[model samples]
Target: MDRLTLRLPPDLVRRFDAAAAGRGGRSRFLRRLMEEAAQAPLPAPVAATPAGRTGKLTLRLAEADLALLEAEAAVLGLSRTQWSVALIRRRLQRRPQLTPPEAVAFIEVQRELRRIGVNINQIARAMNTAVLEGTVLDLEVAQLAAFGDEIRAHLTGLRAAFEGNLAYWSDGT
Candidate 1:
């Protein structure tokens, strides 16, 4: 490959480094960006409507904020505009928005809770059958109690995760 050198401002370099972190470093990230840009079709210009809406808005962001936005959007596989619009809608609707990682965590927690529920249900059915047959199941009662404790702990952890997510959105962080 041919070598090319370009000089960039220190602040710009810092932002680039921050955005490139965990993305296979600067070179790979830059190359992927270049490839995407090359393949992406140019957006057509928007014409003004008679109602005077051009459907265009612009914002000036600080370098650090821009870097953070780009990093987050990249992680979610979304464009900055998409991310911003979702955030705005979420805020306006007073709804919580979870990142992909957060969503995955919640999904795993839900699966565990479901599994626990199934186990509890099976234990209850077995106990009911034993009772109907005039037999006592001491072991099953102990197991059911243990399962109840386990479910309580899981629910507590799940509640904490939800509260943390809510706090994050509440603070706009």
Candidate 2:
């Protein structure tokens, strides 16, 4: 479809938006209005549909707000009821909120991970310095370097466990 660019004063724009609202937004409303104008003079605004299955939810909002709602609903090929219901359901059914105990546990796990990270950084720095200085490695540092593969594997396992617990807690698993 071709786009039309027309400039209007702020007051006229506001009036145009108000007229288009609650009746399938600017494009559809304007189309209908133009057709009506060609045939005869314009009439009063269209009344809203009944609440139907859902209970009433009436609000007096700005014309632009109404137009935005109508446009969004139309984009999904949904009536206002379906669109609103879907939005409500999506917001209501997000991941479960953490309890106090769970929140504490989560923070503790994060702290432990940071502590482990700091230890790893210290080890790496000591190892790098020993290599650069051509100094003999300490017995403990030698053992740690020898068992690096096992240490890395254990850290990877810990990370997997953390992720699993996080998903379980967040998703109510």
Candidate 3:
């Protein structure tokens, strides 16, 4: 790997950092960008189309956002505009139509479920590390096992709550 130093404008740097934060870190983000650029299809000429075949929509993005879009488009073997249109269409098509209050409640439930999952992961990791170190006493292992059971109970409740809502809209609900 080669190391390169870049001197970018402060505002651009801020935007880049923000984008990188969403994707783990700067190095991974830049590596993905380079890979995308390497694999991008050659730009093709735009041809005249029949009337009403398609319409144009223009957007102005931060440099960081544009780079991300370009990378994603490259991965999909699509032009940036085509990729954006496809993504937007899929989002609109797939999402459920919920009342504002129902939407809020659904999002809250999802967030809580995610939080519980994270907590469960942390507890499992701690138990695994203790076992690997050969320091987990019998009583401590039993406690951890009990805690795991409790996490399973919470997960069951969350699943029941989600099912009770009966708001599966994607499959022609």
Relative to the true structure, candidate 3 has a C-alpha RMSD (angstroms) of: 21.9
Score each candidate by Cα lDDT.
0.80, 0.65, 0.69
- Model 3 CA lDDT for position 23: 90
In angstroms, the error of model 1 at 48 is 15
Against the hidden true structure, what lDDT does model 1 obtain?
A: 0.80
Q: Where is model 1 more than 4 Å wrong at Cα? A: 1-57, 71-83, 132-136
Measured by TM-score, the strongest candidate is 1
Clashing pairs in 1: none
Question: Which residue pairs clash within candidate 2?
Answer: none
lDDT per residue, candidate 3, 53-147, as tens digits?
96778798999999998996776466787667655654576533343455676677667767766776776787677654444565556666776
Q: Estimate candidate 2's alpha-carbon lDDT, on a 0 to 1 scale.
A: 0.65
* Stretch of 10 with least lDDT, candidate 1: 129-138
TM-score of each: 0.54, 0.30, 0.28
* Candidate 2, superposed: residue stretches over 4 Å from native: 1-96, 132-173
